[model samples]
Target: MKYMSICIISFFNLIFFSISLFIMSLYFIMNEYVIFLEWEVVSLNSLSIVMTFLFDWMSLMFMSFVLLISSLVIYYSKEYMSGDLNINRFIMLVLMFVLSMMLLIISPNLISILLGWDGLGLISYCLVIYFNNVKSYNAGMLTALMNRIGDVALLLAIAWMLNYGSWNYYYYLDYMKNDNNMMLIGGLVMLAAMTKSAQIPFSSWLPAAMAAPTPVSALVHSSTLVTAGIYLLIRFNLLLVNTWMSQLLLLISGLTMFMSGLGANFEFDLKKIIALSTLSQLGLMMMILSMGYYKLAFFHLLTHALFKALLFMCAGMIIHNMNNFQDLRLMGGLSIYMPLTSSCFNIANLALCGMPFLAGFYSKDLILEIASLSVLNMFIYYLFYFSTGLTVCYSFRLVYYSMTGELNCSSLNVLNNEGWIMLKGMLGLMFMSIIGGSMLSWLIFLTPPMICLPSLMKFMTLLVCVIGGLIGYFISKISLFFINKSLNNYMTSLFVGSMWFMPYISTYGLINYSLKIGMNTFKNFDQGWIEFIGSQNLYNKLVNFSKFNNVVMNNNLKIYLLIFILWIMILMMFLMFL
Candidate 1:
């Protein structure tokens, strides 16, 4: 009860602060006022250690949404972890997680960014393992290891930036583009962001991290952990314009978007499906970001946070009532029983599908429209639209299985939307999911994004979305005959559905070869010839020589004395001759 009250009180405080920050951000955005404050922590020779805080409209705005979602996640967790003994610990970890994100957002210094960056990774690992089970442990390990790749990349970027004398990459980002030696920093930064965002081979950890408690999922997936990378990219997006690597980033982000969308369609687990959608949205942000539309990406990022948080909260409510069962195959007709949850879930889901007048439409539609207007190849253009379609496909698939389908539950199970606290949490995001898009759209863009495109190209997004929805609905109702027929292409579905074996590639695919080589190294070197020739062989020879000397000295003292006398005589004779 004490812990519960703490979270409840904290939630109210955070929400108040979040609202204040949002208002401040609007003022900052309108006036174009950037408040940069720096404190000199220390100075060594010419190098001054300064901690910098950047309160621009972008950072302020992004941090506002982050705090808003975090506040609700805290409020939601009160009931989510109500029965747990360590709700206090969970609250601490969640707050720590939010603080780390705040640090990352406000700092322009690479060193400070990394401090916050590493804090995020560390706190996330703690949260992932909060359930303290083998699944959580494994998931946490994967999450930590995967994020460590980004941490190392960011560390390397910091080291490379040392040549520039200060770790403030923001100050030097423009200068970095011209110097070949310095341009490497952009690639390093890009690599770091990609790893953090869980692109391609790094993608497996995002889904597996669903082993975390649902409230953690709501926070991590929506606004904090995954978005951290996208936010960083938004900060450095200008580098993508002049660098040759931007094309590669575009391709990678597109593939990540498409891959995650496909994976979500095939996923059965409720949380994992939402997790995949988060990944898909991340990829979308990165895609536009690589194209140098940082503001659009940021816009999408903020909007995505609102709806995705609501989506996860709704999914949590469902899972909570379903006795922790997350398989959508077993969840059906949830709308009939839990009307409020179903309504929120469907609205968030539709927003995810980029439905008109919703938060997603304002950003997502603009991104695709702008991308369509760009002078890009047909392949890249198709990648953007096709990935959008897949987003709708998987979203409607979820609706079919969870909302409108037959209720597949065990006897004696009772499902209702009874938790007022959790419901309140979802309601805040639900209202935002409806209006957050236009709200952010108005604030972020002084002028609307204009794209003079053919009508077919303009309407293409809606057309694809509709067709994709129909396909997704029918796909969810797969007939037994089709299931039998798909046995032939089971391998294909397995490949695509399993994120193209990305989970395997990320987990077993990554670990097996490394572990195999390590074992071989141990067998052939550390435990084998090196052990014999290095320490063991040296020890054996030293012991044998010591024993030989001991036998002569102890067993034959006369011989020892005679040798000493002979050595002295020889030394005396040699000295006399000299």
Candidate 2:
């Protein structure tokens, strides 16, 4: 039975792999379809396939990473979700998520793109809430609601473009001839991207989304969903290249980076901390995108997927080892019991912390170099640098608190490294974490700049990692401070202050106040005019008046009375005129 189940799962994976390869090849073959259509050498209407080849090196690299991560998620799920009653349902959802994400990556038109965009969001919500518990339901609901805001913006932008007779991405490219319209579209696109990416106010849903299983969190949160925003911006790079919208992107991205980094510092739940770190890393990618460093942003995205997925999976192993205990406080001295798990966890953490010779080091350093260039504002560069330091602090804290501290509780039955299936997945991802940068360098146009201090900068980054880890270790070891004090304070301030203040800042405040006043005026009317009418027994009086009129209208009496009333009215009007 187990062997049969494995074969069925393998069959599904084979189908997915085949589809991915076919789409990738088709995208490459149709690379010049856009150019040919644009130059009018080929009639657009005559073309059977509406081919907009998103086959640039950066996009191809990202797509490859997406496919690789998604395949691992499926493989991991085969074992992870082995005996659940709804295992078939889970596999179906996983397949759908992969399909939607692929559609999103290759979509050439804004309208078609939204099909995949909304589809992925829906699938993710389903995946997150797959356990169907109350907490998971709440998390799914929050994700659905928050992403709706982004979807609305995206829909509006698409509507606005379509209303102006632009139905496709190519039309928008041509429409950019008008600088004003270009700026408007750019602003709307950035708004959509910001919300989808969970920048600032939109970021709340992401951490809440951690109620999902570790694999779901690993794939959706770390590898795919959040990266969608960065992908959109990069996909439409020409629109953002020289516009005020680019500045807005930089500002929002910078704030998200700093704030999420700080948030990561305070989170106690292992998954929640990783979620925040994902947010911060996404912010850095956005910041890099805004700087027009597509290659660097793509590189970072690749490296991030590798290490973040590994981290979450390692966290999963830890949780599983401890019999589903997610709190790091209760998880101490796990290294001795689960050496293989701890080793993989440490390697992933080191990569995440941007240790030298790791994937993160090269990609992050490239972003920092671009940020430091004189073209960007000084404040922006410093903000990026500060966020980088914070990244180190949180990444290592996750490592120290969970793995290396003194043994506090008796060890539970630790599962054997769960054989080759799970570990193979982790090891495959770990290999990418180590060599992703070198692979990316060959895939993309990025060449290491011939700067004298490249080595020095690498050393400094490592030093920061070491120092940051030490600080986190000491704080965790000696301080009487509560573990999640910083996070609690931050969330409290956000909910109590900012969320409350939103009503006052928006036009809704005036509208709500006006509604209250209007209701009071209606109340006054009811007390005065309506009360007078009620005192007269208006409905009853009307019935009585009709009864009296009916009696008077009886037979000849009705005719006499009508004549008399008409004469009296005529006499009065005549007298007034005279």
Candidate 3:
């Protein structure tokens, strides 16, 4: 009862606070007000540390969404985590995660931002390994180490920012980008964002992190932790525009988008499928953000968060009803039994694919149109629309496999949508996923973006979705693919299904190679050079020196006789000379 109280109190309080923040954001936006509150924490010999908070429409709105999702997640966790003895600890960890995200949302100072950033990494590691299994531990280690790269990059950025005598990035963001040192800082910040967001070269951690509870996935991975990097880049958007770094980011994000979408199509793990979709959406956000469309990125961020959170929650319910099985092949014809949950699942999946007038449509379609009009190359354009099609492809494939085929669960399993406790938490985000996009668009963009293109060009988004959906449906039925034909061969499936072997590369592949290199170094250097020239060589030399000394000392009588004979000979020589 006491443990449940923690969940109840935190959930209700957060709901109230989130609603309050939403109203405040509306007022703040209408007034066109941005407030900066700073408190000087310490002053020492020309160095000052100040904690800074930024309150504006953007920050307030994001914070409101975060708290909203987090509260619902907590409410949902009450049922999802009820069996665990450490439910209280889980609730507290979640609360701490929300607080850290809030800190990240409002802070303008790099020092405070680092606190929030590190808090996310640390707390996420705790949450990921909460199940106390080797799989969870491995996932946590991978998640933490991959993020640590970004942490180091950000720390370097902080150190370089010392030249301006302040850790506040806003004061110098506008003008200092041209300075060489500041450019370096911008690069570091972008790298940090890339790692945190799980962009290409660092994307192996997101799906791996599904070892955590589904509630954590709903709150942290889907909504908060992954997006922290994008939000930071949005704040630093001015520095990234028209730079080589942004150009590079655009390419990398586009590839990540393609890679994730392709990977999801070949995956069977239900949670990993959604996780890959999250990764694909992140790539979309990063792609647009890199193109200087920060507003669109943030808009998509909010909208994607709503639906993606719901998607995870619905998946959680299904997984729960199935008695913890997550394999897509092991789940079939579930829509027949769990109507409400299936509807939510289908709607969220459709939203992810940018179904017409849904939440994703408003943001994703607009991003593609704007991207098409940009002065970019055909390769970049292909990446955008092709990734969009792949998104639809994988999403449709997931829904079909999970909801339409013969029942694949165990004979004893009885599926139903009767978990009112879990449904209540999902219901909040479910409605938001439907309307959050339109409302956010109207609120965030004062003047809607004017997009003009030819008819076929305009139809490109719909065209791809249709084609991809058809392919997704037909491909799943293909005996050729299921029978391990050309495209389904061991090598090809292994490559695409494993996120292009990113998990292996980012985790054990690199690690294994590194350990081998260290072993070789030990054989070549430590054992070879140091052993020969250092201790062993010193022992040999000392042995020889000791032997010579021992001979001279032990034969002291002979030495004295030799000395006497020499002395007499000298005397005789002296007499002869006289």
- Which of the numbered candidates is closest to the native, going by highest TM-score? 3
For candidate 1, what is the TM-score? Answer: 0.89
The per-model lDDT (C-alpha) reads 0.88, 0.72, 0.91
* TM-score: model 2 vs. ground truth: 0.78
Estimate, for each residue in 1-578, the C-alpha lDDT of model 3 and write its tens digit. 99889999999999999999999999998999999998888999998767899999999999999999999999999998999999999999998998999999899888899999999999999999999999999999999999999999999999999999888889988888788888898899999999999999999999999999999998876678999999999999988989999999999999999999988887778899899899999999999999999999999999999999999999999999999999887888988999888888888888888998889999999999999889989998999999999999988888788889798779899898888989998888889888988999899999988999999999999999999999998888782256346565574457988888888888788889889999999998889988999998999999999999999999989999999999999999999999
- Tell me the spans in candidate 2 whose CA falls farther than 4 Å from its real position: 2-53, 163-166, 171-178, 409-416, 452-460, 480-578
Query: Which structure is stronger by TM-score: 1 or 3?
Result: 3
Better of 2 and 3 by lDDT: 3
**Where does the lowest 10-residue lDDT sum fall in candidate 2?**
32-41
lDDT of 1 by residue, 413-467 (tens): 7988889889999999999999999988888999976789999989988999999
Task: Please state the error at residue 234 of candidate 1 in Å.
Answer: 1.3
Q: Where does the lowest 10-residue lDDT sum fall in candidate 1?
A: 479-488
Which has the higher TM-score value, candidate number 1 or candidate number 2? 1
> Which one wins on lDDT?
3
Per residue, candidate 2 scores C-alpha lDDT tens digits across 1-578 of 65337535654564476457546644653462222222223556656434343444344446667777777766776666665767767767766776777777766567667888899889889988988899989778878877888788788778767655644665566546356655566667777777778886677778778888787888886667888888888777777775676787889889888888776666677887888889889999998888777767877887888899988888887776677778777776778767888888888888877787888877887677655543767688768877778787877677777777665545545545654566767777788788976766554542556444566654655565677777766666553275346645666457432333332333245468889888888787766677667864787789899998887767667678889999999999999999
Clashing pairs in 1: none
**Decreasing TM-score order of the candidates:** 3, 1, 2
